[model samples]
Target: MKILLNKFLPKWMVLIIDQLIMSWSFALSFFVVRQFEFAEILRGHFLIYIGLFCIVSLITFYSMRVHTGLIRYSSIHDIYRIFSAVLICSVAYAAFVALWLAPVHNIDSVNIYLVLLLNFFIASTLLIMVRLGAKALFLYIRSGTAGSKERVLIYGADGYSILLKQALEASNSGYFSIIGFLDDDPHKIDKDIHQKRVYHVNDIENLQRKFNIDKLFVFNEDLKSEFRKKSIEKCVELGIKVLTVPPTEQWMSGNLSMKQIKNLKIEDLLQRPPIVIENKQVASDLAGKRVLITGGAGSIGSEIVRQVLSYNPELVVICDQAESPLHELQLEIKELFPDANVAVCICDVTNFNRMYSLFKDFTPEVVYHAAAYKHVPMMESNPCEAILTNVLGTKNLADLSLTFDVEKFVMISTDKAVNPTNIMGTSKRIAEIYIQSLNNISGKKINGNNPAGVAEPQTKFITTRFGNVLGSNGSVIPRFRSQIEKGGPVTVTHPEITRYFMTIPEAVQLVLEAGTMGKGGEIFIFDMGEPVKIVDLATKMIKLAGLVPNVDINVVFTGLRPGEKLYEELLNEKELTIPTHHSKIKISKVRNYDYEDVVNDIEELLKLNKNKEELRVVKKMKQIVPEYISNNSRFEQLDMHMN
Candidate 1:
């Protein structure tokens, strides 16, 4: 029986079996017509009638190719074929007997027609049922041999969910056994679909207690729906792992594969609704315009590059100091946009000569300055490099934008720059001050000499500030994920530390929107919804990975690193935001400086950084921005001296 269930019968054997079933149906028809008097029915032309019916059935069944369907994977289409073949065979054979055979053999047409009618019904039922029965039997045997199947419940009771279930069952992988469906619809509660019960969301706990469901399959769209979102949260809270069904568009060759079903990640749960942008405005602004991205190889910068490319830019100059990452970004652009006009340059933003050559060559109308030393601790230890890059690099780019007449200079800033407590934040705060001061004095004389020696600046310097970006390089989310994967302690800086999280793409979208809207001298802060606790984020990530926090994976509190904030603030105590046209973006009413004074101070600061006098450089940085105070660092003593 195992072997028979394992291997399918050949086509010829299937044909013979179908023919025998049809013959039996015909015999049963005779018995019914003769009122169970089998001897009477067999008396005169019974042998000839049976032989003639078999011949007709063979011709029709073979012509219709009824035996071609695999019994173990039969579908509604196969059943339809079986029904059509049987119906056609009955009609054709009965018509032939009534028109020619009945008259030629002096047969009673009424009696033969009745038998044919009964035979039609019996044959269709048996044929369809035989295939269905075989499929059930095969699945049962396969499940037993494949070991204990995982009991799962699908999340939605819609047609798409049923189709997904059918696809999963049809696949040769006999590991999952679908118990029922879970839904939030009140109307669908406790209903039966395909013999499986439709369960309500409120009953999830009871269902889990009763059946111990291994997983719940949810459609990708349901993850975005509000009601479904709550249901998914409940399931997660119950420790029932949820698997996401990819969109139908991602299905391979119009069929869902087992590999395409993925475990739900914490990102999915944390991501908010999609942001609506002014696509036409951004497209018009960027179309055919030359654009420059300073950190084009980094996460936010690369995404900006991609989004800019989609706007049909005339040329994109990708400037980054990282060699391999720049090359990889170039390759990715080539592969994704074969006809894209992009130039990749390996040049430090702090180098005026190299950057000057780039600006002269590309003559970009728009520049997005993203290059900076962003790691808090690293910058805390190395203040010289931080000032050089974050301050001087930004200065170099702003100066060149003026010399080159760039239309927009969007500088990516951080929330850490708001009343900064570390060297990294202070340096960024200095950069923001320089750009805003420069914007205040645009198209006018400044103290610094440009390469072109042009006095009037045409560039609009705009600053965008936001908190931590999820999944970016050196971000906490990826670090936690890596630790979890290594099966050990996941180190979070503090238990109560909280930071606002935004997806990389979401942040970049706002950047582009903010860039397009800026006239000049505006510090645009994005509305990063609610702050997420670091400890809670860590715990949820461990749960998402199917591990218990402090049990399977130890989540250790390593205390706050140098210059780390227990909470990040988007605005300083002295600053307030004015409403912009965009709801998520607002302009900061920040203090501005005189361009001449800032230029002189920055020049001296640059000299100190050039001599690698880290202390003097940091001291000058603090003097320029008095709000810059060191927290839990070696430089804290400097802050004390100044105070």
Candidate 2:
């Protein structure tokens, strides 16, 4: 029977049914007026009046689309339509009787008005009630047929909360049943919303016990971070799955759905306030310029490429050695900006001739150098590759930028370069030093020499440094997520280890902003918020996955890998940062290097073969970066021997 009703009836059938109900209502109204005298209602003008009422009601109902809604899925809109149709029919009938019929037939006006009013009330009420009853019956059938429904509680009692409940109820899946609402507002506590009592957030445990809530849906916009964290923590402790709806703008066709509700992620919890960028400054610098981005297919590189498109660059040259990722980026750019001019260059940055040729062909006005070998442990084991890519690769781009007279060359450096502890860090530090010295030397030469005496280099070398980017290739977050999905122990290098984190987009935005602000020879450092402990992060991730840390999922502490530091530093002790126009960005003050000496040292360092004499290569690195200390690795012995 329910299945048959689920098959929606045709519009004509619904119209016919509604007309029949209106006719029955009119007859019932007459019987009530005439004290159940059926003979009088069947006589004279009564039959004609009933026929006219049916015709007018059918016309109004069809005009208002009152019969267009499915009885089993009727909503408030459908009810309003029904009311409109009945009210219009009643008004038309009263006007006819009062204006013509009552005076001509010598009938009482009050009696006629009363009969029409009663007819309108009965018709509207019965029509709405039948639809409501059918809707309830369908819901009951669905709830019973779909197996056991998970009892859930909403964490907010606001408008979004009500919408969420409606969406869940309307869902054909019938998996979730909303038990009640939980809010932080003291005044709202004990109040009823949408037929559900609103309980204080503190009463979650009690509510869970009473209602057996298996899930909690969070939809509050003004929820405090601390309170949110605590509430989620409590929910995890109670074994209640926490789900969240997307922002209202993301809703499909202004309607929410169960499919749109997703499990809260660790990234969502750890995310800080969004970093606002000075768009005008970035746009002014980049507009109409041909921008070249090295390693433009990697995580940070790709994001930079995407963001740079907004400034309307004359041509964007995406240069990367990785062929497949670069191809992927080219396709993405083509799809997103088919009209914009973009070029893809599969040139290795370490190959000087190739990069030189690239620079000559493109003649890019600005160069954003983001290519580097950044994995600490991997680079520690393969120090030769690290130097070849990170250090020499940067030098090739920097030298070519100067030679090509590019307006600005921005080098993307990392926090690990500050007071380095690994091969990767030291290599990046060396790169930073080379570019800064090159900037200073070039500026001095241009200022000191006559224009005819020497061809002046007019390039500004800018460096932007920040900490780890969330969800980057081979980052800890993805690794932890994969481990959780595999249902095993998530690996942590050290329990006490901590690192600063920022989203990839945020880091790239600041880089662009810093590029515009740089004059020459300045290393801009971003303000990375408080470092997060690895152990705490791992624990939270496990809990977010609905598993107890060390109980449901074991968190194993693997001893620190080679050259991996206990904590990463944003600035070396010797370096002091001066204020920038943006509070989140600062300019670092460091000791200047002689361009000649630094060039000689790097040339010699790059000369050694790492496979035959790895220690010799590492010793040269330490010499270049005196503060480079090897921790928990074979390179540590080199530091002791040097001392």
Candidate 3:
């Protein structure tokens, strides 16, 4: 049986089999009509009649290509093809008898016509039955030997869901046994589609109890709908694994494969509504302009590079200190946009001469500064490095943009920069101040603030601040996912600690929008919907992995790391945000700084950092940004002393 079902028969072989089946049908018809009188049937032109019928069947079936479809994978179209072929053969035979046989010989036309009609019915039925019977037999034997197939249920009862079901069954992977469909429509519920029952969405629990369902398949759009989101969550809570079907565009050759159906990830459920951007506005800003993206290989920066490249920029300079990642980004850009003119520069943003040469060479009209050491605890241990890169790197780009008369300088900031309790956040806050102050400096030489000999700086400095990006480098989501994959003891910083989460794409979209709308000296903050608890995130991640939270894998809550806060703030106590044209973005009403004072303080801080004065560097950072109070760190002592 396995050998027979292993591969499809050749078309010629299938044609022979079909003709033999039709001949058998003709013999059965004769037996029925003659009342088993074999002597009477053989006494006349029975041999010639059967020979003529076989020739007609062969011509009609071969012309219709009815044998082209695989018998084991037959569909409704195949059945229709077979039926049409048989009907045409029957009609042609009748025409032949009337035109040639009936006139030339004394024959009973009624009996011949009756036999032809019976042959048509018998042949059609037998052909369709043969294919269906083969399919059923194959499925039955395969199921019995291929282990117990997982009984699954599909979420939607629409045409897409039905097509998905057909695709899965026709693949012959022998893994899923679809029990029924769960639909929210009252008209579709309790109805049968393609021999599968459609149950109400509310009946998932009952269906689980009855059939012991192993998985629930859903379309991609269901994740965006509020009602469907809750339904999926309910299934997750009930411990049924949820699988999501990719969008139609992702299908291979317009057909869904078993590999295309992926397990739903926690990030999919946590995502907010789709962000709509002003495409024309962004295109106008970036089109045909030389754009530079610092740290272009990192998560946020890489997404920025991709989005900006789509705007048809004249040239894109992807600069980063990391050699391998920078090379990889260059390769990716070449693969994705073969016509795009992109340059890759491997140089530290902290080196003045290197950055100066970069600016002189590329001379980007728009600069997106994303280079910074962003980890909180890691920067807490090494404060000076944070200041040097985050503050100095930003200053280098901002000052160069002014000297080169760049149109805009957009700096990526963080929510932690608001009430900065860590060195990383404080350093970012200092960078923001320098950017804002430079934008506020009206037509001044900056008191001889190193190079950039200009009367009035033409650069529009902008800052975009947002919360933690989901799936970014060293983020909690990826960490939790890794821990769950290893099979035990997923660690959460604290049970009660919560942080605002946004997808990397979402953050980058808002940044581009903010950059487009910024005039200068304005700090833009994205609307992070709500704070998610660390423990809950861990639990959902474990559950998404098809494991129980506490039973299958233990979630251990370690104490918060140094300089980690229970909550991240987008706005400080003294600042307020006003709504912008885009709902997801707002401009912060932050205090303006004196350009001279900011320049003086930052220059001294850079000198201290250069001298490796870590303590002095951090102390000077606190003095520059008064909100730089440390939390749960050795630097917290410094905060207390200042108070």
Candidate 1 lowest-lDDT run of ten: 247-256
Q: Candidate 1 — which pairs collide?
A: none
The candidates, ranked best first by lDDT, are 1, 3, 2
Residue-level lDDT tens digits of model 1 in 1-643: 4475558789999999999999999999988998988678767688888898999999999999999878888888899899899999989888889888888999888888899999999999999889999899888776775446777899889888888888777766546888999887889988999888999888999999998877888888887776788788788877788889887667734547778889888788878788888989999999999999999999899999999999999999999999999999999999999898999999999888999999998999999999988999998888888988999899999988988888999999999998889989989998999999999878876564666877676789999999988889989888989999999699988889999999999999999999999999999999998999989989888887878889899989998899988989999988988998889989999877888898889889999899999888889988998988888788888978998
Please give the RMSD of candidate 1 to the true structure. Answer: 4.2
Q: What is the lDDT of residue 79 in candidate 1?
A: 90
Supply candidate 1's per-residue lDDT for 342.
Answer: 94
**Per-residue lDDT for 1-643 in model 3, tens only?**
4565477789999999999999999888877877879899888777877898899999999889988888877887898899899999989988988887788877777788888889889988988888999899877766765446788899888887888888777766646888989989999888999999999988888988999888999988889887888889889988899999987668734447778888999888888779999989999999999999999999999999999999999999999998888888888998999999999999899898999899889889999999899999999999888987999889888888888788999999999998888999999999999999999874555556546565676788999999999899899888888888889799988889999999999999999999999998999999999899889888888888889989999999889899999999999989988999999999999888988889999999999999999888888989998978888888877777788
Best by TM-score: 3
Q: For each candidate in the order shown, give its overall lDDT on alpha carbons.
A: 0.89, 0.85, 0.88
Q: What is the TM-score of each predicted model, taking all chains together?
A: 0.87, 0.87, 0.89
Task: Give the alpha carbon lDDT tens digit for every residue of 17-42 in model 2.
Answer: 89998999998887788788777756
lDDT head-to-head 2 vs 3, winner: 3
The global Cα lDDT (0 to 1) of model 3 is: 0.88
- Model 3 misplaced regions, further than 4 Å: 1-14, 26-65, 84-121, 136-147, 168-171, 174-179, 186-211, 248-255, 449-454
Q: For model 2, how many clashes?
A: 0
